[model samples]
Target chain A: EPEVTQTPSHQVTQMGQEVILRCVPISNHLYFYWYRQILGQKVEFLVSFYNNEISEKSEIFDDQFSVERPDGSNFTLKIRSTKLEDSAMYFCASSEAGTGHGYTFGSGTRLTVV
Target chain B: AQSVTQLDSQVPVFEEAPVELRCNYSSSVSVYLFWYVQYPNQGLQLLLKYLSGSTLVESINGFEAEFNKSQTSFHLRKPSVHISDTAEYFCAVGAAGGYNKLIFGAGTRLAVHP
Candidate 1:
């Protein structure tokens, strides 16, 4: 089975630094998404991407955060200025179009903002 | 808007014992129901989903969920669980529209003991 792939399984960064988390979704999948889970908290939606543009974003995805499908295969989430509260497990996911097919998720990138 | 509710924060069961994780959702529009699993130090994996045809869905592993439209619940059940089944389970809802942004519930941690 095809699975979404994410890079930098773990990352540690200083507060106010910039960070980029990368993911490679399933090739045929058109819908991409970014979600984050804080320690002992629920997983929260950050943004959703389709056709190379963000279709929807949550309040948590403020001016500090952005997502891009930089290349045909690479989907990335960038934090302009990270805060200590930004520490969480960030996950990337992908799903097909026009169907209720469940999504495939990548092994998350654990981001620790110090 | 949509919201998911996972009643149990944690469930501890002995090996080979049956288990049930309760999930309820509220949505203004028709939505898709999904169950995702996260094992130790890993990302979310789609366990199963309820799209349209059937109210009942099953995963490859010995797990099943029944979608109760009246009650707005999709509770996951496993007749007998193994240690390998120890993980966190999340219930989520996606509106039936273009953007598949998901609303997730606080996860239920399942701990299978020997």
Candidate 2:
């Protein structure tokens, strides 16, 4: 089956450094999303993208965070000056339709800020 | 906003035994329900989903979930499980409208032993 692909299975960075996470959603998918899971916690929605712009975002998605569909196929999340609390597993997901349908998720990038 | 609650943190059962993972959600509007499974070090995979029509949905792996509107529940079940079924299962809720973000539960870990 087709899948969403994410680069950098793990990343470790200084607390104040900038980090960019990349994802290639399924070829036919129209909606993209980013979610994060802190250790032993519930998965939290960060942002949703469609038609090359952000459709919605959660409170956790603040000024420090930004998402872009840099190219036609690649979706990227950039965190400027990451904080220690930013350490978590970031998952990229895509769906052909919307919430009424199921989503396909990438393995996830484990971001660890020191 | 929608919220999902997984009552059990962990459930241990021997191979060939039956199991159920409880899930409930609170939502003001119509919602879509889904169950996802995540194996160790892997991405989340859709187990099943309830969008419309029948309240019960089933996956190819013998897992099933019934969406109960009145009770606000979507509990996952399996009549017989295998060792390979061990994983963390998450229940999620999303708005019925197109392109809505998902709200996920903390997750329930199922450990199927031989």
User: Which has the greatest DockQ?
Assistant: 2
Show model 1 residue runs off by greater than 4 Å: none
**Candidate 1 lDDT by residue in tens digits, B15-100:** 99999999999999999899999999788888998988889899999899999999999999999999999999999998875657
lDDT of each: 0.92, 0.95
lDDT tens digits, residue span A2-114, model 2: 98999899999999999999999999999999999999999999999999889999999999999999888999999999999999999999999778777899999999999
Provide i-RMS per model in Å: 1.8, 0.7
**Model 2 agreement with the true structure over B2-112: per-residue lDDT tens digits:** 899999999999999999999999999999999999999999999899999999899999999999989999999999999999999999999997888999999999999
Angstrom error of the Cα, residue A15, model 1: value is: 0.4
Worst 10 residues of 1 chain A by lDDT: A95-104
All candidates: CA RMSD in angstroms?
A: 1.2, 0.8
lDDT tens per residue, model 1, A1-114: 888999999999999999999999999988999999999999999998887788889999999999988889999999999999999999999988732676788999999999
Runs in model 2 with CA error above 4 Å? none
